[model samples]
Target chain A: MKKTLFEKIWERHIVDTLPDGTTQLYIDRLYCHEVTSPQAFAGLRERGLKPFRPGRITCVPDHNVPTLNQDKPIEDPVSRKQVDTLEKNATDFGLAYYGLQHPRNGIVHVVGPENGLTLPGMTIVCGDSHTSTHGALGAIAFGIGTSEVEMTLATQCIMQRKPRTMRITLDGQLRAGVTAKDIALYIIARMTTGGATGYFVEYAGEAIRQATMEERLTICNLSIEMGARGGMIAPDAVTFEYLKGRAFAPRGAEWEKARVAWQNLYSDEGAVFDKEVHFCAEDIDPMVTYGTNPGMGIGIREAIPSLDSIDEAGRISFLKALDYMGFRPGEPMLGKPVDYVFLGSCTNGRIEDFRAFASIVKGRRKASGLTAWLVPGSRQVEQQIRAEGIDAILTEAGFALRQPGCSACLAMNDDKVPAGRYAVSTSNRNFEGRQGPGARTILAGPLVAAAAAVTGKITDPRTL
Target chain B: MRNTFTILTSTCVPLPLENVDTDQIIPARFLKATTREGFGDNLFRDWRYDESGHPRPGFVLNQPTYKGDILVAGKNFGSGSSREHAAWAITGYGFRAVVSSFFADIFKNNSMNNGLLPVVVSPEFLSELFASIEADAGTQLTIDLPAQTLTNQATGRSEHFDINAYKKDCLVNGLDDIDYLLANKEKIERYESLVTSYKLQVTSK
Candidate 1:
């Protein structure tokens, strides 16, 4: 039988079928972080059990660590405790840990791929929704709850009912100014936040094939936003080239052998998906979200949809979202004053993302009243920013690069937008108060965020 | 872990707003806690409270007219982030079940594993639930887990839902993922050995 790319990787990871009809899936790699893993580690201690394969696990403290002043101890007692617990747990379990100030420390999703821990035809598990970010390398990765985290730690496996498969194909060439983030936002708008529930999605077609690995990572990072179990792309030459010299990647003869195996990781030509959708890359715009949910998005030049255009069942929530955003029906989102602009997160905190942001902000002065944060996804990305002179351009434009952490993408850190402020963010989510109490997040791509940073409001990059 | 989840019949608190994501359920700032306890206090903390930290009179849970063990929320409940704190909050707040027209996949799984029943009903039925509860503060719904049915006692309406057969068994037995896997340890070890030998053979080739 012809197999889809998801199926090919999934079947390889199956250990056995449980009597209850769930598959016992073997996990190749497990990534842990400060926020979610403490409880799982506690669970392990309570049971008097140790990790089945300690070397297969890697721990990092990202969610609770401060983006600034990493040399000092965390001042927030609660955040301090979480980070301390992870450090102790990692040491106790004999797992590799990259805590704050470690040379390789970064967001779990970013560091995994940067260090070449993520690989093709592997099954990765992390206690994070953005673990799908690793699927860019053709790995079958997804988030797990604390209990499932404990399951993976104890047995190196998880019990899961296989999900149906869906394929989203993006064909044709992207227009200038459009980005992987824009394509992702466009798809989420068309699919709604719950569109692809109960399935694993495989991204294919010309545009995806053409996307850089970082771009592919951005696309896969948002898979959970649309309610998919996960998303993946087949490994190709681009993938191999990216992984070739990474710290943890295979070398020499092992690399050659791995390449041979990864070359066969694509879906067979005749394989059929349970559901399939196609979009022209030209149809996507430099996208932005206007409402509370990521799904409520439109092109930069477009107006928010009128309430009359929405169904009765959805109209009430639609109105509520607009009320929360302080946006009127049928109003153009362009030129709306933005108080803050954020450029970091697993979604768009990569080196390419920084380059894109720097490209737009090159010679322009930042808007007088705007506060923009430029955070890198990893230390490697931060180093690249400095090495490539993007940091100088940013500093010249009045935006300083903050330390690497999941800052402003979430409110766990000190870098939070104040109440009732509108922030143009490149983060994946724009949910109510996700950045802070009463802060309204407007989700956009790197270019759009850069435009907002310099213009002090939502502006069409095309107009800029 | 608490076991044996057979049936639950209780009143419900309704949150009519749609897309009530996990972040809203429990804000990211509150996620700094290492343990799962005390999250119930912050369940819907921002929505339930004003900036000054006083309970908002307008929020559903704050209203004295409604009180219940079940939380009937709007569609796509528990979307965003796999914090598991959302499930922790619902269960921590003593909600035996959460009913919605749809649930984000990870949230649903987390709820099921954490001793909280996630009941998925038809959109029309979900609407009926909101209306029925609103009309009468005394509204009670019964969720029969083994039977896979959710019934509205006020309206005498009932709907059958689907659950994985294995999950159904676990729920009834009060078994979590860890419990089940531990019970089947030998099976796991055997499978691991098989996988090890298989990998070795492939690498040798």
Candidate 2:
């Protein structure tokens, strides 16, 4: 049978079919971070079970680690306890652990692909929604609950029913200054948050094929926001080029063989998906969210939708979201004042993201009223910033680089936007209080965030 | 870890807001704890309490007049993070089931795995549920897993819901992923050997 990329990888990992009609899927790699793994480890301990294959698992501490002062102990007792517990659990299980301050330590999703731990045709599981980020490498990856995390740890497998497949095809070229982040936001806004529920999406067409691996990762990282089980891009020459010299990637002869296999990873010509949607890439703009949900976004130059534009069932929540965001219908979002600008997350915290931010703020100074947190996705990315002189440009422009961690994205650590303040963030979700208690977050790309940092308010990057 | 759910009938607490994300269900600050047991105290912590830890008077969970084991929330409940802690918080706060017009895929899966039912209904039926509960605080509903049906005892209204047959079976038997996988150990071993042979053939060539 002709199959899509998702089905190809998924079928290769099936261990057995249970009487209950769910597939027992074998997991090739399992990534764990401090915030979600402690309970899974505790469950394992309660059952007196050790990891089925310790070598298959990798652990890190990111969400709860402070982005500043890595040398000192975490001052927040709760954060300190979570970090300490992950280290202890890793030690007890005899698994590879990249604890805070360790060179390998970084955001779990970033660490996976950069280290070549994420390979094509593999089944990856993590207790993080951003696990879909690894799908850029042509893997079947998705998030699991803590119980599934424990199940993967004890058996190196998970039970899953097959998800229907959807193909999202983007054609045409994206205009200059528009980015992968904008593409994601634009798609989510049109599709709404629950549009892709119960489906695994395979992103295709010319625009997706032309995107850089980093850009593809940014796109796939937001799959969960649209309620897709996961999203994948087939491995092609670009995918092989990105993996060629990485640490955990196959060696010379093995690489040649693996490349040959990966070449066959695309969807068959006659393959049929359960559903299909197509969009012209030209329609996407520098997007930003005006309301609490990520789906409540509009083009940077467009006005917020009027109440009459929304359906009766949605009018109430639409108004409520506007109230929380301090926005009004028919008002342009371009000149709204911003108190903070956050330019990091699994979605856009990569080196490419920093370069984009630096390009915009090279000679301009950061606005005095604005406070910006520029964090790298990994220590490797931080080092690259210095090597490439992006660090100096940012510092001269009145911004400092923070250590690599999941900072301010969800306010798990000390980096939090004050309540009632407006922050133009490059993170994925802009749900209510996602940054901090009562903190208002406006989701945008790095270009928009950089523009906000320089102007101290929401301003179209094209205008700047 | 809790009771095996076959049929559950209870009054409900209503949160009429749409897109109640995981962060709002249980904020990220509360996620740092090593144990899952205490999350119940902080469930809806920001909305439930002020900065000084005082209960906010306007919150539904805070109102003494409303109490139940089921939470009838607005559309798209649990739409943000993949934190299973959200499910822990809901279950810990004594909710056996959450009824919504829709649920974020991961949250629904997480709820089921943790012995919490995520009962999805039609949007119109969901609104009727909200209206019924608002009219009388004592409105009761019964969820029958075996029959895959939900009935409003107050208004004599009923709705059919869909759940994965595998999940329903697991929930009714109280069998987790580990338990079921362990039961199929021999089949899994056979499959592993087949995969190993296939790999050996490719590498040898």
Candidate 3:
């Protein structure tokens, strides 16, 4: 049978089928962070189970660690305990742990690829929704709940009912100033939040193939927002080039063998998918989310949809979302003043994202009215910013790059947007209180975030 | 551990808002705790209470008229985040099941794993369910796990929902996946050996 890339990878990882018809899928890599892993670790302890494949697991403390003052102890008692618990669990299980202040310490998703522990033709699972970010390397990666996390820890396999496959083809040259973040927001808006539920999406066509690895990672990072089991792109020359010299990537002759093997990772010419959708790159604009969910987005220059545009069934929720966001239906988002500008998360905290932000803020000073949180995804990315002198440009623009962590994206630390404030965030989610209680988030790409930083309000990046 | 589910009957709390993400179910700041207990106190924490820690009577849970073990919500309930804490909060708050027209994939799985049933009804049926509850807060819902049926007692309307056969079995028996995988450890080891040998051949060549 002619198979799609997802099917081929799924087939390779099957250990056995449970009588319940679920596949016992072998996991090649398991990434853990402080927030979700504590319960899984506790479960293992309760069952008196040891890690089946300790070598396959990697742990880091990102979600709870403060972006600033990482050298000091975490001040919040509960947050401190969670991070301490993860370190204890990692030590107990004999797993590789990148603790706070470690050179490789960063967001689980960001550090995984940066160190090359993420490879093509593997099955990766993390206790994070953004684990789909790793699927850009052509792996069958997805988020799992804590129970599944514990299952993988005890057995190195997860029980999964194989999801149907969907192929989303975005074909055409992207407009100038448009980005992978815009492409993601564009797709989610067209196909609402639940559009891809129960399907593993494989991104294909011109736009995806031409996207850099970092861009591809950004695209895959938001797969969960569209309700996908996961999303992946076939490994190609671009993927190989990205992985060539990374720390955990294969070296020398092993690299040659791996490259040859990975070359066969794409779908067969006549492969079939459960569903197919095509999008034109020209249709997308530098996007911004106006309402609470990721799907409630519009092109930057467009107005919020009128109530008549929302179906009767969704109107109540639509109005409720608008009320929560302090937005009026049919109003333009172009000049809405914002109070904070956050430029980091697994979704957009990469070095390329920093570069994109710096490109727009090169000569412009930040708007004095709004506060800005410019955080990198990883220490490596932070180093790249300094090495490339992007830091100088940002400092000149009156912005300071903070330490790396999942800062303000979910606001687990002190980097929270104050109550009732409007924030133009480069994070994946804009849910109510996601940044902080009573905090309003307008999701956008790094470029859009940069524009908002300089103007202190929602502005079209293309115009800036 | 959650008790096994066979049949659950209870009044329903209606939240008509769409895309009720897990973040709203349990906010990120509340997730700093390492343990899963006491999450119910903070369930829908922001929505149920003000920043001053006072209950907002306008919210459904706080209203004297509405109280229930079943949560009926709008379409696409539990949309964002893979945090199982959302499921923990729902179950911890004593909700045996959540009814919606649609559900996000990870949230559904998390709910099932934690024994919180996610009942999906047709859009019209869900609308009617909401209308029935709005007309009176005393509307009752009965969910039969074995038969995979959800009945709105007030309207006498029942709908067949879908649940994975294996998952249904697990829920009925309160069985966990880890125990089953442990019993099949030999199978996993054999598969790993095969994969390792295949990789060895590629590297050597």
Candidate 4:
């Protein structure tokens, strides 16, 4: 039988099938961070369960670490304890941990790809929801819970019922100034966030084929937002090229063999999928989220949707979101003033995202009181941005590029939004209290954030 | 240790909206409480009440005749942030199972491990189930853990569902990750002693 990539990998990982029909599938890699891991480690301790495969589990303290200062203990005790706990758990379990002070330390999602620990033909589980970020490398990666964390720690396996497959083909050449982030936001807008429920989305077609590994990661990162088990892109020459000298990837002779196998990772032509969504890149704009939910988005030039314009069910939520955002219905999102402009998080904190922001902000001064913040997703991205002169461009533009961490994305560390402040972020989520208490977030692309930083208003980056 | 699976076929209440998020399930403001207790009262707290905190007469849960132990929500029923507080509030509110056409990756995993059954059914089957449930609030449904079947007693519709082999083992056997480890205690101790001895010998050499 011609099986999907998922079926092939899942069958390969199946250790045993329980009587209840769930497969006890073996996990190849387990990535964890501080926020959800302490409890899992405690569960392991409670049961006297040692790490089943300690070597494959990599720990990083990203969620709770302060992005501004990396030299000292975090000021918040709760955040500090979470960070310290992950360190102790990793040490106690004899697992590799890139602690807050470690040179390689960064967000679990970013570090996995940067270090090549995420690769083709692997099953990766992380406590963080953005674990789908690894799917860009052609791995089957998804988030796991603390108890599932305990299960992976004790047995190096997870129980998973199968999910239907979706093949989303977005063909055609992308427009200038449009980005992978825009494509992602556009898809989220069209899909209405739940369009691909109960399915693993396989992204294909020419646009995805041409995207950089970083860009592909951005696409896969938001699959969860659209109700997927996860989203994945098949491995190709670009993937091989990106992983060529990475830290954990196969090298030399092994690389050739791996490449040969990866070449065949694409979905077979004429293969059927449970559902298919087709998108043309020409119509996609540099997208931005105006409301709390990512799906409640409009094109950068479009006006905010109001209760009067929407259906009955959406009216309540739409008006509620508009009220919370202090945005008037039918008003244009462009030229709306911003309190902060954040260019980071796993979504847009990569080197390419930085390059995009710098490309726009070059030779321009940042808008005063905008509090422009740029956080790279990983130490490598931070270094890469500096080497590429992007950091200088940003600082000259009045945006100070901060250290790599999940900074203001969630108010875990010191980077928080003051009450009633509005922020334009490149992160995946815009949930209430995601940035801080009463801090409204509008999710957008790096270019949009750069434009927001320069204008202190939501302007179309293409125009800028 | 409550291994006797009291399989109740839940009277499904359809929350047909897509992208029902964590905030909608349990409002974020209620997260200030240090413990998971008292969250049940606030499950879908915003939707359950009017602007003045009075019960919304139209809300399904507050209806005079609706009584259910299961909730059947639309796709992305648990999308958004990974707050285990959603699960706490849900389970505390007496929902033993949440059947959905789809669930968020984090929220589904969180639900299953927190001892709440997160069941997935075909979208077509779900639409039919929703129709039946909406017809009668006194609808009694039985979810048989052993057979992996859902039976609507009122409608005489018996539907089969699929669960993961390992999660089914855990949920049905009442064995969590820690319990699974304890069950393998003998093999674990044997492996530990062997590893310890090998380490000591290498150091001595």
lDDT of 1 by residue, A61-131 (tens): 88877888889999988899999999899888788889887878889899989988888988999999989
Candidate 2 residue-wise lDDT, A80-100, digit = tens: 998999889988878888877
**Would you give me the overall lDDT of model 2?**
0.89
Predicted structure with the largest lDDT when compared to the true one: 3
lDDT of 4 by residue, A195-282 (tens): 7667888899899999999999999999888778788998888998998887777778877777787777767766777888899989
Docking class of 3: medium
DockQ of 2: 0.48
Give the C-alpha miss distance for residue A299 in model 3, angstroms.
Answer: 1.0
* Position B43, candidate 1: lDDT: 92
What lDDT is obtained when candidate 1 is compared to the true structure? Answer: 0.90
**Cα lDDT of model 2 by residue, B1-205, tens digit:** 4469999999899998887889888998888878889889889998899988999999999998789899999888998789999999999999999999999988998999989999999998999988999999999999999999999888898999998788898899887778877777676667777773212110000
Q: Which order, best to worst by DockQ?
A: 3, 2, 1, 4
Regions of candidate 4 where Cα sits further than 4 Å from its true position: A18-21, A306-311, B1-18, B23-75, B82-85, B92-102, B119-173, B177-205
Model 3: per-residue lDDT, tens digit, B29-60?
Answer: 98887888878889999989999999998999
What CAPRI grade goes to candidate 4? incorrect
**Proportion of true inter-chain contacts also present in candidate 4:** 0.21
For each candidate in turn, the TM-score is: 0.98, 0.97, 0.98, 0.84
Model 2 residue A239 distance off true place after TM-score fit, in angstroms: 0.6
Kindly report which residue stretches of model 1 are placed more than 4 angstroms away from their true locations once superposed.
B196-205
**Model 2 Cα shift for residue A257 (angstroms):** 1.2
Model 2 chain A weakest 10-residue run by lDDT: A12-21
Candidate 3's displacement at residue A234, Å, is 0.4
In candidate 1, what are the lDDT values of residues B94-175, reduced to their tens digit?
Answer: 8989999999889998998888888899999999999999899899999999889999999999999988888888788887
